[model samples]
Target: MIQRFILLGEGYTDLYELFEIARTNQRRLLRLVQLDTVISGQKKSSLVVILQPAEPGKLMPLYLSLEGVYPPEEKETERYQLFEQLSHELDAPIHRLEVKPSADFNELELYFQYVIGVLRLNRFIPPLQ
Candidate 1:
């Protein structure tokens, strides 16, 4: 199986799109994750929706909404409230994790790989082939 991150946008405004993908692919929804990180002194969050591998290609999509909202635990935000609402609607609890900020890496690809590694290590996603 091949798993890859499909970035929606920096959580600024496109988080709704991520929720839409999950809602539309409810059957394929595997995991809902909230990646918390401190970027440039600001605590932020990245929301992810993992989907089961599809037939014919076996591509497991990991939809992402990059750091767009403040950490919900630290401070309440409309975005996080919406996420909680969506999780309730889907009956899937969000998995919250603290991780290194993307800014730590020189490139986003490296950051993605790092997150993938963390997910695999934590059993949030399948091991790499």
Candidate 2:
């Protein structure tokens, strides 16, 4: 299966778009993830929505609001609240994990590859075929 991360921009207005996608694609929704990272001594989070592979195409899209939102653990934000509401509505528990910040990578693509590797190792996503 070919799995890829589709970034939806920093969680601001983008959050509503993310919520709508989850609500609309509830049937294909696989898992919700909150990737927590510390960047320059500041805590931030990236919300991700994993979806099952498309039939015939084998393209599995992992939608993400990449490292833009403040960590909901420290403060309550509407974006995080929306994410939580999505979990409740879909009955999908948001899997939370602490990970290396994207700043650690030289390129954004490298950061995505690292996340994909971690996801595969944890069996959250399928291994290469």
Candidate 3:
């Protein structure tokens, strides 16, 4: 299966679009993740919506709004609240992880690769097949 992160945008107006994607594709929705990271002494989070692979293609698209919202543990935000609400509505627990900020990587693709490795190690996603 080819798992890829499809970044919508920073968690501004694009967050609503992410929610809609989860809501509309609830059946295909596999997991909701909150990636917590500290960037320059500020706690931030990335919201990810993991979907099952598509038929015939085996393409699993992971939708994400990277490092845009303040993690609810540190500060409650409307964006985080909506994500929580979506988790409740979907009956899927939000998987949280602490990770290095994207800025640490020389390129954005490297950052994503790191995240994929972490997810695979945690068994949140499947291993190589």
Candidate 4:
């Protein structure tokens, strides 16, 4: 299967949109992931929702809310709480991975590719075909 990352926004208020996507597409939901990385000095999280491919589908979508969440360990953020709620509601386990911050990459696209490679390597997503 071919998987592509679709960026929703940089967390903030747009996080609700990610939740809605999961709620609305509950049946198609395959996995939930929280990508954690330290930017500058503070720890942040990017929440991702992976959905199964739709009709005529070779493309599986990985919806991302880029590094907009405060790591719960340092501070209990409302947004991350909501993500937890989503996990309970969906009966899905939220997978966590430590990754290099997108800022480390020269291009945003390269950063995304790096994440994809990581996800595939961990068997979170299918292998490249």
What residue pairs clash in candidate 2, if any at all? Answer: none
Pitting candidate 1 against candidate 2, the one with the higher TM-score is 2
Every model: Cα RMSD to truth? 1.3, 1.0, 0.8, 1.0
Comparing 2 and 4 on TM-score, the stronger one: 4
The best candidate in terms of TM-score:
3
lDDT tens digits by residue: candidate 1, 63-102: 9998887877679989889999999999999998999989
Candidate 3 Cα errors over 4 Å, as ranges: none
Please provide, for model 4 over 1-129, each residue's C-alpha lDDT reduced to its tens digit, 9 standing for 90 to 100. Answer: 778899988745688999999999999999999999999899999999999998778899999999989879978989999999999999999999999999999999999999999998999998878
Model 2, span 38-76: residue lDDT tens: 988889999999999767778999999998878776778
Cα-based RMSD of candidate 3: 0.8
* Rank by TM-score (best first): 3, 4, 2, 1
- N/CA/C clash count, model 2: 0
Q: What lDDT would each prediction earn against the true structure?
A: 0.90, 0.89, 0.92, 0.93
lDDT of 3 by residue, 1-129 (tens): 888999989846899999999999998999999999999999999999999987777888999999999988799998999999999999999999999999999999999999999999998999878
The 10-residue segment with the lowest total lDDT in model 4: 7-16
